[model samples]
Target: MSKHQLKAVYVISVAAELAGMHPQTLRIYERRGLVSPARTQGGNRRYSDDDIELLRRISELTDEGMNLEGIRRVMQLEDENVQLRRELEQAREIALHAIREAERAGARGGGGGDLVPLKQAVAVFGQRPSIFDRD
Candidate 1:
């Protein structure tokens, strides 16, 4: 099966069961906008493995005496952090791909072999000269 098909997405009831919480609590969380699940064409909620994990975290936080408002803010911050991490990972992969492509091109004896020096490249881009340089 493809990676998309392998995703562990479940209905609200199933997710509630997995997280050991009542379905009504899940609905309450949804109503509070704590977790936004994917919706079907019929507007039924679909919970992914990530959503279940977040629910468990919310449960844990609440059990520790955090109010719903505090939990909501924490969840929002956590979600933002997760998104930033994913973006950083994608950027790293792109940079690695570019490095590999450059190496291949350089090995082919094309003009690509004449890559600009770091300082020269920075100068070309109008950046200040390297700090290590003597006046």
Candidate 2:
């Protein structure tokens, strides 16, 4: 199957129809600061796929007995967690790639030295006295 295009924006009515909600409900969500729709030159609101998905999430949270304020806080925390996870994953990938690149460069330099174990990279930077040091 082809990948879906998420770049398109729907008008308030169309978005409401797609989300199984009324246009006024969408406006209420905007008023609650739950979803921010884009504005056209004529100042009409346009809801993107992401906005619709957020609306659905807000609806689900509300259905689950969460107040609007609680939903807002939950959504904020979820967004932050997702961002942090992405950053951590990216950092891990970069570290792994750097290790591979360094190994390749070392192999080409004709050092013929044994490859250091992954655990030793931290020690290579020098032993800073740690408060938790047992030794």
Candidate 3:
């Protein structure tokens, strides 16, 4: 986890105040699997900035008339979407880097020996030409 993800300094009361929620509500949310705060050695819950933002998001979703289960599913999908976007970005970067390397190799008089050749073909979609209409 990153430093921001692990930094949990705010106690429950302070976290609730920051999130504009009651302490008990935070407990309820925790039980519902909405927000998970860190814990101290004494088993005291400690909220991170990420947790605070998540609480705020939960509040917003609650106000939007979504049930707890629906909110959980929505948050799960959103997390998946974020992960997919990150993977896509990484793939794009790798492809671009490969293309640049190929261009540099070609510019340096390399015969493109590292590359594989493929055949190309074209097709006319709508109607066959008269040249192909011979019976």
Instruction: Give the clashing residue pairs of candidate 2, or none.
Output: none
Q: What lDDT does each candidate get?
A: 0.83, 0.80, 0.89
Q: Give per-residue CA lDDT, model 1, range 27-120, as digits (tens).
A: 9998998877787667888888888888999999999999999998887898799999999999999999988988888888767456786543
Provide the lowest-lDDT 10-residue window in model 1.
Answer: 117-126
**Of the candidates numbered 2 and 3, which has the greater lDDT value?**
3
TM-score of 1: 0.56
Model 2 spans with C-alpha error above 4 angstroms: 1-8, 105-135
* Model 2 clash number: 0
TM-score of each: 0.56, 0.68, 0.79
Over the stretch 1-135, how does candidate 2's per-residue lDDT look in tens digits?
A: 112223536999999988888999999888988887887668888788887788888888888999989999999999999999999999999999987877887878946554765432233356674534554
Error of 2 at 25 (Å): 1.9
Ranking of predictions according to TM-score: 3, 2, 1
Model 3: per-residue Cα lDDT over 17-117, one tens digit each: 99999999999999998988888778999999899999999899999999999999999999999999999999999999998988888888788445776
- For each of the candidates, the C-alpha root-mean-square deviation to the true structure, in angstroms, is 6.8, 7.3, 4.6
